[model samples]
Target: MTHPTLLHRARVLAQRFGIDITRHPSDRTGDHLVRLLDRFEIDTVLDAGAHTGGYGTLLRGSGFTGRIVSFEPLTAARAQLHRAAEEDPYWTVLPYALGDTSGTIELNVAGNAGASSSALPMLPRHRAAAPGSAYTGRQKAEVRRLDELWEEITAPGERVFLKLDVQGYEGHVLRGAGDYLDEVVGLQTETSFVPLYEGGPLFDEALGHAQRELGMSVMSMVPGFTDPDSGQMLQCDLVLFKQSDAREAALV
Candidate 1:
């Protein structure tokens, strides 16, 4: 972040040239996410796979002041996540992974800042494409079912938005969400196009389960993990809203 005076001057200079530096045609994921939450009157955000509070920080930076409960299992990352939310009274960080059941699981720690760390085994394609994302070690992590924590984390009638970034564990998290999925108004999950993780569900299966079983319709698909050489998108973030929501309502 630049100094306030310098930022102001830069904005002023850009405005004189008939341009808005802050507004662009490229990906503005944060804006779209916050807009959806606001439109649906979301009171709380359940960040199912928060890694060092990145998504939670994105929400706060995107002007979402609602309560955020971020769940992370990695010890180091969880510590960092706690520090990130320490200043915000409404932001909370938990040291548990959301999965199909409550227990412990072995996580494949990635070599690169634990960004690629996942409960599932990393596949050769992922390691070959990004060496830094390869597994370096293993760690045991506590797991929790989202359904069991739903009522504890939220109040009745409070609209909720659940965000999942669990590498290949989207299905597990949703299954754990169970009947509480009906209570959620919207969600965003990272869907894999290939087998980046062993036993991972591919894009079509993930999409079908979300739409058919979860009762959601696609809102948007944003390119996420891409192969540097082949230029193929291995994963994408799929944002969906409940089919019961007012799709005909004006977004403007």
Candidate 2:
């Protein structure tokens, strides 16, 4: 929670960008996100970690009127996410996980549900950072490459913005997209500085692939999680834009 005086100042700052942070101070951050999407003319979003529609809800509340296609693998979470978007004509929810390959995979369901669920095993550092993020159990879920469902997730002439919040499985999601990456104009992925999930790619590996191999350039990065005691950075959400050169060449 932000201090009252600090939060009020944040709201005042956000108003400069024509944003109202009274609803959610975090929504103030959406000003930058909205600007980036608008810059790319993005009108569609591929939400990899739908997780009860929290991200989509935030985006819509922040004044984005784009079509949102959300992916959630957990049965319980998908049910809630579906209910949340049931009345929204532009929002759609899918019950599946995206990975490097298509098949069934075991997802570790976190005790707290949405925030910590992942295909990879949780590490000690994760528990140390967030004690409530312990795995409760595992469930087998359908996994597919984003490319395989590209047509279903997107519509014609809709520039896509991809958001990957898949605990530590963002690398697998990116690998699965492969050539489909060309269709995305921008992306926001959560990367970790410390190992939170076993066998998951850290910030360098994930950022390297997106920049060097996928032709995305870093636009912004916001710290996500930090150790309360040591104040050590644990995770961050990285915003990236597809290189103009790749965009033009791909368009050709």
lDDT of 1 by residue, 1-252 (tens): 856676556644543332234443233778888887887788999998788888898888889989999999998888889989999999988889999999899998887678788999989888766766777899999999999998889999888889998989888998898898888888898988889998888999988987987779898887666665565768888998887665325443
Q: Over the full model, what C-alpha lDDT does candidate 2 score relative to the true structure?
A: 0.82
Query: Can you write out model 2's per-residue Cα lDDT over 36-126, one digit (the tens) per residue?
Result: 7766778899999888998888888778888999999999999999998999999988888999899999999887655689988889887
The number of the candidate with the highest lDDT is: 1
How many clashes would you count in candidate 2? 0
The 10 consecutive residues of candidate 2 with the worst lDDT sum are 12-21
For TM-score, the strongest prediction is 1
TM-scores of the models, in the given order? 0.86, 0.85
